[model samples]
Target: MFVDTSKEVRDPNVSAIAALDEPTRRRLYDHVVRRPSPVSRDEAAAALGLARQTAAFHLDRLADESLLDVVFERRSGRSGPGAGRPAKLYRRSTKQVAVNLPDRRYELAGRLLAQAVEESDATGAPVREVLHRKAQELGTHLGEQNKTEVFDLLERYGFEPRCEGDAIVLANCPFHALAREHTETVCGMNLHLLRGVLNGLDEAGLEARLAPSPGRCCVRLQPAA
Candidate 1:
């Protein structure tokens, strides 16, 4: 079956809070999301009930961040064909931000875990160790089609892995710490699935280490087993 989700052009605005206070940042995100097309600095400001000058200042800053690109330059004002200048139009970028959300933290953790370990095998070490041996387990799991499937599965679980030294390391897993706070039941399970995900892959060929704490659950890669 096929479904058509009407295409929506994305707002190329990333959260640039350095110059803007939190409130203004939120307003900017909202403005870009709701705006039909690239809006003039003045229009954006008016939408947020801010002054034109202030809006221009922030808009330019957004452009610097690659979050916005100028689509057209125009001069809008009262006058004639000989008007002083025209305003610029900025179209939203085609990039959109999608957030992963879970209805129940525990359940969400389970789904994440289940997805992470789809390609795990236990050859050495604790053949079926869960929680304690997540990275180890996931190392071995590969797909019948190709290793790419295994790698992709990890990505689906939001595990961005990169090769380092002798092993594959998880670049980022946003759920790592959050799962700990949300509930302990699945945090352990998460580790378990992670292990299963790595299972079967040569242990000695790849080493996975929970990066130094205070990090967002990045598994450092190296030779294992």
Candidate 2:
């Protein structure tokens, strides 16, 4: 059966995080990333006082999760067809991983804020207006990319979406800290983002509304009048 690569791409962070759960793996990971050059399994084992086999196992696991990158080289400074198979070297992957428990996406907010500032500087538009517009555009684009149910799309983006009768209750704010620190600004941005999502989805039966609740997201999608 054909597999979904988009889902696969989004999943490595979870695997990478889980790979670090083992004490030995964590130590090896720390050690490898600290080195300026790639590390061999033997070198990692000796540095961390682990058996070569143990080090190799964890290293391979890290590579499997894309936490580490693998390369081959002749460690003896010799090159020839007769020189035998090159040693496998491991290095820190260029990939970045961020797994927020409540699924906060501060980075997205930061980017939008930065862009708004730059555009405001260039065109003398109000930064707040630029930010809200950009956020709405992004939300609309996100919704347009999906043919799945709106709730599924929200869940995929870590909204922790659930239903309360006819309304959709988002249980987690993906911008939790920002929302707390700058409630008015962030909540307004979020409200517009959800509105854009609804518009892009052409969801005539639902409407995005700001209805702050304790222990849940400040925005709710309710049935249209």
How badly does each model clash, as a count of residue pairs? 29, 0
lDDT of 1 by residue, 148-208 (tens): 4345555545566555554566655546556556545344444555555545432334434
Give one digit per residue, the lDDT tens place, for model 2 in 56-136: 999999999989999999988888877878999999999898787868889888998899999999999998998889989
Q: What is the TM-score of each candidate against the true structure?
A: 0.36, 0.85
lDDT of 2 at 130: 89
Scored by TM-score, the top model is 2
> Backbone clash tally for model 1?
29
Weakest ten-residue segment in model 2 by summed lDDT: 1-10
Candidate 2 whole-model C-alpha lDDT, 0 to 1: 0.88
Best by lDDT: 2
The list of candidate 1 runs beyond 4 A from truth reads 1-21, 75-86, 98-225
Error of 2 at 68 (Å): 1.2
Model 2: residues with Cα > 4 Å off, grouped in runs: 1-11, 78-84
